[model samples]
Target: MNVEKKRVLKIFYLIATSSEELSSCELAKRIGVTERTIKSDIKQVRDFALDNGAVIKSRRGSGYWIEVFDSDKIQAIVEQLVIHFAYDSSLSDLSSEKRSNDILRKIIAQDGYVKLDDIAYELYLSRSSIKNEIKEARKVLESFNLGFETKPGFGSRIKGSEFDKRLCMLMLFEIYYHKAVLMFNHTQLMNYFECEDDVRNDIRHSFLKVLRESSCHIMDDYTQRIARYLILLRNRYKAKYYISFNPEKKVLLKSFKQYKIACDIIDELKKYGGYDVDENEILALEVFLLIWADIDSTSDLAGDYGEVYFEALTQLEKISERIRQEYSIEFFNCEWDKKIFLTGLIPIILKIKLNCEKNDMKSSVLFNDSVRLSPLSIKLSYSAIELLNEQYNTKNSFASHLIIAYRIYIIISKVKYDYSPIRMIICSMHGIEVARSIKNSIINKYSEKYFAKLDLYELYEMRALKYDDYDAVALNYPYFSYKYDWTFVLIELIPTDNQLQELYNKVILQGYQLKQFLEFFNFNKNFVFRDFNFESMESFINLISFKHGKESKFIHNIEYELNECVIKSIYNKTCILFINHQYVDHNIFEIYQLNEIKNINGEEISHIIVLSVDFNHSIKAFKFIEQLSHQLVIDRETIYLLTESEKLDNIIDIVRKGLNSEMISLV
Candidate 1:
């Protein structure tokens, strides 16, 4: 089995070993993935289980649990499969992340300095390759306050405070626990602490007993984390690696309830291991105890008391006020909702305060889909969060922002739809020469009488255009009028008196509908054009960079992503709509109108739209592009309008209102 397969197996193993069914949300959180991905992963796991003579039982409201018959045989098969694949030299072929993790685990599990050559040999890689892996792994370790030290003879080793060292171990364990447990086994894990099996077992018992005796509650996840820390702390204590708490930490320690708890744990250690724990070690334990308490309080935010709770509430109040001012949506409408939400923010605030590391897993696929599916919620939540950050000096993670977005999404879904202004897009093959006047004349005629906004676009014979953004797509020529599910109208650039009245009746008076106000004529009786000219694509990319990537810190990231799309289009020689959302936080899209200039060889090329938005707001944009690309093969008039039209602002405006349609009940 590959590592991914092994991971799925481990998830199944956890579910099988659990006493109760696990929710998809909780499972995704534990596995550091989005719930949407988890659902698909679960289905794959279910299929695998069926072939393996096992069952994954799921209930409608509850969740999934595993069922296995003949546990011994299943265990034997799993263990054998895991060991075989995990130890194979093919492990070197794993992704850079997996390879780096392998090297890090090897470095930390060793008793002394780990030679690069030894790692290369173990993982089947070159010495220089292992060095690069170590370099990458160092980045991850640094987040936990751990660093690497290199000597002349011995290669390199991790050097950090004993506390940080244990924390790094736990963090790594979460990502590669199954692989490490299977490959290194329990004995090596004990060897990392320079202890025998009996000593390790005694330390575990004493640590838990102390926690139980002191009535200090530890969550199951944190219990595993603390247990590992205790083992390392014992070895470090024996080796005389004690913590030297500064005056500031000591001052903070004085008021901590966990201090007494730490003292009790130290007494238990002395009883079991027959070692007199020093004052410095006791203080170190207290620090760990305090951290444990922080973790515990965060587990159930509503139940937490004291400074953390009050501080979060204050921040929430400022955030709420800023949101109301910017979006005109009242967030603090009910005291009950406010309290529940404020409690939720506690964990997010704690994470920022601690500078906790997040999993490298990208935002779940569901997150992207949800943002598109709930435009109103996304718009309000994204705008509000931006304002909150500026006003309250709070830096929330993307995931935290997503939580707020989801909450507002639910609330907004429950309310009645607000009246929205109708947006219409007009396209003409005569280009901007006629599009502007037609749009202005129509808007002037109808603006006072109806709630509608009209914009004009030029029609392209070779380019696909997305008409979904507009309530109606008005076309000038018959062949130019593409068939789409959206409301479309065939009218002349200069409408006749009867045609103008018919347009007013159909669009302004009749709300929204498909209407051919004027008769369609085949005006292109004799026309043949093979030449297609376009302005330099780079100019538009630069324009977008100037518009969206002015922030110096993000310029490189933005350019790097843009270059990938540019390269992709150039190599394929295809008209592309590039939407890069890797680093942005708001919606931004740009169109590069292709000009019909000729080269020395008189060859012509096409143009593209470099529409970039935040990752959350990209689903609808991507769908639009996908459909547009298909339409390009069947109809080219849309691209003509896009390149030749002067209504760039109108096109952008319609796209800005892309996902903001009112919710319609199927019933």
Candidate 2:
């Protein structure tokens, strides 16, 4: 039977096992699907069960129930169905979402094209429904930069670099398995991946043994997750889908200690488990270990990233400095904050450069919502974005920016709100009357928002006790050290507003802010030339003019106009020179890169920005540049990150979304 028949059989079995009649609505809720879908499923279930020794009886008022004449035959048929749906079903069977995920796995697992007709037949869906599934599969494949190619006779296959294909397959495993859609326990998963029962048990034992032999501190749960990753890796290779890592890239990963251990583990799997694993798969496993192990700043990312690791570090350092300068908050002081920011930021930077996925509009909503909750973080985050947009060649998607913002929010939440008001347990020796009086006075004097909650506890019960559950202790009686760092407030029989104010000051810490307004500047890539020499800077303008077949004097005219605008470094590090030319044939706004140059007035000089406007497109360019300049002053990091790796189209798309100007034409 195909998946749809198996589903209908499972539903029928459920109703048969039930003592009472079941309504379609109740079954739909249990199955996590629509009532209409359940009704359709019931028709198939009734037809399939009738010849198989069970009759589904329905009355006018009552719902549906099952009656069996030959229990032996029905039990035999049900056993057959269980064998068919093994490892993919639960107490309940697959829902529509789970079915879709299964279809995706099937498509990826196949080494060659899988026919749409075969898929439809197996899933018990019409051609149209299967077509819709294809669209979803394409969306997922496109996000990984894999091609969902189809031919008239050849059907379809996901095409991509082997490295990316492996990454996508592993990510799919993580998403579906974590959600319990695959519904396979460790041993079952191994069996599904084609491991023999003995081999499966040995692999499990060997994986744990390897972890023990090495002093790795991964928990059992994480060890299991890694084992699942290995299953997928071995399964893919066994099916002839292999990943080949570049020899140059492989050399770079040798610096990581985990890489060596991963290699040893693979060797053991090959020796004992009767599996053939490739060198590239071993390298990929190392990447998975680093991410899943949750390594902090102590991790040598250079093993996976090569020289770019140091560049990423410099970028993170610059971002931290901006946050500290703008918010007056320190991050490095808190080890948790430092670890989180670094671990999250490095992978994100690599993903952006690789253009691994498309940005969903929903992630932008999350970014905005997070910023709304914290107002001060916005200025610093925006500043970071602007700097990144201006400096990097890479294009950052809104989703990418949102992830960066989330990491920043994690750090800022610790820095900004760590001293928020505490919950209190009020204790008094004078009985409930005195405690009530103090509590009422405090509540009426200050809003309940200032404190989490106030509870009354008797003084006698406070002996030899530590109130660790509450944030602070409030009492009128004398007390000794309880070994907690919480605020302890004592009030008189009647407390004054002045005493309340002092206590409030101690409870609520002061926030940080910039003493002066910081200004920013925006430079287009055409204008940005890193380590530029004077002759080369002038040569680039002439080359552009010559390429457009314009007059040589027009180039000289641009040089003359450059004097009108001040050329200075906006970040106090790199100088940018920009010129807006009048009435050119093309509306050109290009950023040019230059190799580093020294001995220009005994100081390093780089970046030449050109933002030229044609007579007709002048208004649009002017409006866009105006908005760009504003973004530069407030948030340079946005510009820097956007420009650093590459994403001009995305940056322009962001600008187009933000600006509703009729005069500004992005196309």
Candidate 3:
């Protein structure tokens, strides 16, 4: 039967077995089909039931149910359908995913060319269906570095390295057979492989014994997979199809301790199964062992495995550093978390380095869904894959990035700090008690919902206070003077509801300001250039100018402002150069660490801070830029931190801290 007919049969079976009426929505959801498709299929089901001594009844409010006039005939129909749909639900044509998988399995299982007509007949599909599935199967084959070859009359075959072919076969076997259950019964194995039960049992027993003797901690699923691989290998070797390894790689594999384990398993195979295997087969087994064997810690990876262990550690550290430099987030803070990540990461790194990475569509879809939820994690994962590709000289796949990003998102979700807080100052002229009362009331009201740090100050001490240290000021007296429009909330001596709400609104505004500041800068690593050189001031100005073809005049205005208002000073070990310009359409900020000291206006300078702001930009954003300029000239510690920080994220954090202070003054 075709897939749609089979689906209709399955639907009829569901309706017959259901205790309650099944709605079109429920049936569609259960069958993974649309409600419209379900409605049409129900009509087909009704017609088929009428022909087979059964009736499908439906109501306007309720859904579908089945009534049988001839139980024997209905039972016989269900029995025949069960043979096709019981073990694998994919036998029903729902989507191309399973069909494509089946195509891959059929091609990989055959020794030589397999005809399209033969596959179509076996799958109960049309020739067109098989052709469409072939395209998907080809994509999967290409990912495994295998080729799909077809002839006019001879049919199609998979072509690739023997090692890759075996890997592809193992992966497909995992998808098709072992997906439902980790363990397979002796009868199932014998029937599937067409081998004697004793041969399958011997292979399983030998693999388990070798793994146990080597103190390898592998999951049950992987153990079953290894057994399946060995069974397939034995069959392939019997067919005179053997694997060949590179001479250099074979030598390297022989030196590893896993090689001995591989040898032990092969010897058991030869003794019990009467199999003939060679050194190349042993090397392939060693590679499998290397990829699958789980090590709890670096100490567990003794002997030749130590090289892979160390390389995994180095690559992990590089990824961690990249995340930190770009996002200002700590990646590996806890040693336990590091160990957990290392254990999971080692296998993947081994897979990539050894060219055995499995591209499972289900796993890729799941990880991609999870990574999409976190925008920052998505960016970090992309950056991480780029770093790995550069270091290894290999093009990693999207699935690889998704996997890494999912792991990174998990770790970061736990360690990332809540950096948003509204700093507020509470003052009163009525006395300290009134000030304390108002502060306590505000804290008791908003502490749970909003993060606000409240401090008490006398009204007389306002002039002595550093305005930059607080975001909002609450005072009983209304008379206050400041250059920038500060968030001021005038509270009553006893604090009325209206006064408290005003204070809360000011806190909300401060939060908005903080958010805008962060969004404006964004703090991309690309903004910071290290060891950059420019010969003259004109060249540097032109390099920083925005490229607008028709707005050359505006660009010239920005360049003129930058040259006119540039500030140069020698601070500690570096010459700090600060350049600020206004009247631009958008904000631009960059930091440059010169390769050597340059003479700009006869002043030696090594570092440059460029800030360009739009005249129409938000006051809060402009204040932030102004505050940063003020810090660069007067704050010696800020200068030291900006110049001496190794990671761009550290510099970003420093600047972010300055911006968060919300201090506004004349520049």
Candidate 4:
């Protein structure tokens, strides 16, 4: 029993063995507790006696009395309790048989519909116990044509013959699945989820109905569960497939597991299937499998348990690629990941399978009291973000729909109806935009008064990439507004190297490029440079250098007139002059006055340009700046270190405009 139950039972035991008929107050004083606690203990003792076929009688004027007629049953009862707790003993080690019967009982009940957590939880066991139990359960139920199916990370189910042990397994599996799904649907995991519990309830029974209908001997019931476990492992660690859970090894696998969940998927195949699966080459294929399993697990995102969710699209490409090579099949799983957003329940038919017969594109980003939420909603939210990221860059199907849903989750996570706000921020940061967009739509669309409760500014800023701009103040007006300039600018820097939507998103490319971006800019300080921020920082630079032949995407308009009448030579290309913030700020024409204006890239660099602009200068003022013949020399790859100061934007703009002096009077 849990600690609470044990403590309560101890109090009850004291009451049961009391010799005198003491008042609850007196008993409470003796036990150093409140009288109410004594009363509760008496009631509990009576219930326990009744449950155990004993008797505990209570009198209104007197104290409570207990009459024990089944002392022998106590020993047997404890022994029975022992059976439930036996799994805990073998947790660290693998005593396979101890957990077999417990798993077997559940397996017999649910026809291949049990959850692994149920198996683990029912016997007071850990995941390893159930995992070990699978081994023994697999053998004992093998001849009976019975098998166990596990949902690893979720729960376990069973399937087999009705008259057979397998039949019993099927019943047990259903029982576990129904209970778990009920808990999942009823519990408030996601915030502001107002849709009826009935929404999920409506199809739950039907889902079980289908499971019963389709859960035949298509495969060994045990095999199906083991297969699911393998799939779970495969999905969770696609890029990293090895399954060594050593505490030290866990540290090594931490990064690979968190970001590249499918990093070592070949480990499972090598360990279980005994195939020489290549760990690295199989990463993409494993990514596909992870997405596939995620689709099955994240049914609510697509609004259909019967259909696949779009959030699994990134993996679908990997799957498509794998199928082409491994199975010589093309376009096998592409249709499912291509679902458009705002469509009917077709996008998320898996959660409420019954309501989504008709697909509708009229979907809203806001929950708006229409979308119900549960614990699984968090899972769906995560999946939606992954899917949206995949969809955003991958351009697959109606993927943006999932993005909206993901945003809704982001907003809802912050506005917890019952959960703590601290928890909300932690969960919402990863999908900040989703939260911000959802909050805004709710405030405007349905006139939600709860807008004030949300950290609207904080949420929006989280979506922003933090950086320094011209004075580092972002201008958000007309259509919208922003307090910090870099809020939008920082948007370009991709933070934490989130899961890749394609090959380029992988660390080998994306991380490498980002590392280069930081190193080139000498950006050693901490900043959240969103994708837009990285691409937008070139607003001031004049010499736009393109990588792989793309022009430098600049952000600011050139101002001021400093007729540089000079041509400075650089290492590679030809440039009129090299300049800094001071050159532009002072409008100093000394670049031409110097005997030699050496390019910084070249070995000889005698003079430099600087631009200095007042903090309040209008961007439109300095219109007479000298123009360079090669105004397109600044490469997007140029690393510009951002410093936090009042003159940040001015300094950056100086280099940006290629001004020889750092002072400028642009306004």
Best by lDDT: 3
RMSD of 3: 16.6
lDDT of 1 by residue, 1-667 (tens): 3656655765665565568999888677765678887787787788777766678998988989877775765665555454433433432135566677667877775567878887787666787777777777987776666788888798888887765666666555545343434333453443544556687678878888778776456545556556666667776666665666567656645554667778787787776573587666676666545433423322444344356667777877777765554333455666555655654455455444443323221233323544433333444444545554564465444555555665665444333322245667777777876767777666665452344566666655314555555566666768535756556666687766666665654444334211211011111212112243324445545555655664766666555545543432331122443433434444443334344532312233354444343322222322333333333322345445444553332233232222223322222
Q: Higher-TM-score candidate among 1 and 2?
A: 2
Model 4 residue runs over 4 Å out of place are 1-43, 50-67, 70-98, 149-156, 159-163, 166-667
Per-residue lDDT tens digits for candidate 2, residues 452-485, read: 6677878666554565666665667765633345
Angstrom error of the Cα, residue 128, model 4: value is: 2.3
The TM-score obtained by model 4 is: 0.18
Give the candidate order by descending TM-score: 3, 2, 1, 4
Q: Compute each candidate's TM-score over C-alphas.
A: 0.45, 0.48, 0.49, 0.18
Worst 10 residues of 4 by lDDT: 418-427
Clash totals for all models, in order? 14, 53, 0, 145
On residues 1-667, what C-alpha lDDT tens digit does candidate 3 reach at each position?
A: 4579767877886787678999998888877799999988888899988888899998988988888899987776666554334433333434565667666766775667889998787666788878987888887887777878888899999898887877777666655344323122222222244456787787799789878988556656667777887877887777677888777677756766888888888887787664568888888888878766565654454344666668877887898776555434455767755765666566667667667654542332443343453433444556677787788777666656565655665664443223456777778878888988887787676653454567787766766767777787778775643323457788876778887766654454345334445565655445566888987877777777663212666677656645643421333223332222333444455667788888765456766766544323333343344445545544557655655663444443444454433322212
In model 3, the runs with Cα more than 4 Å from the true position are 1-93, 176-192, 195-202, 268-271, 274-276, 298-304, 330-345, 361-379, 390-393, 397-667
- Writing each residue's lDDT as its tens digit, candidate 4 over 519-624 gives 2223213321222212121321333122111222211212111122122122123122322222232222212112333333223332222222221221112111
Q: What's the CA error at residue 587 for candidate 2, in Å?
A: 37
lDDT of 4 at 149: 62
Model 2, CA-based lDDT: 0.55
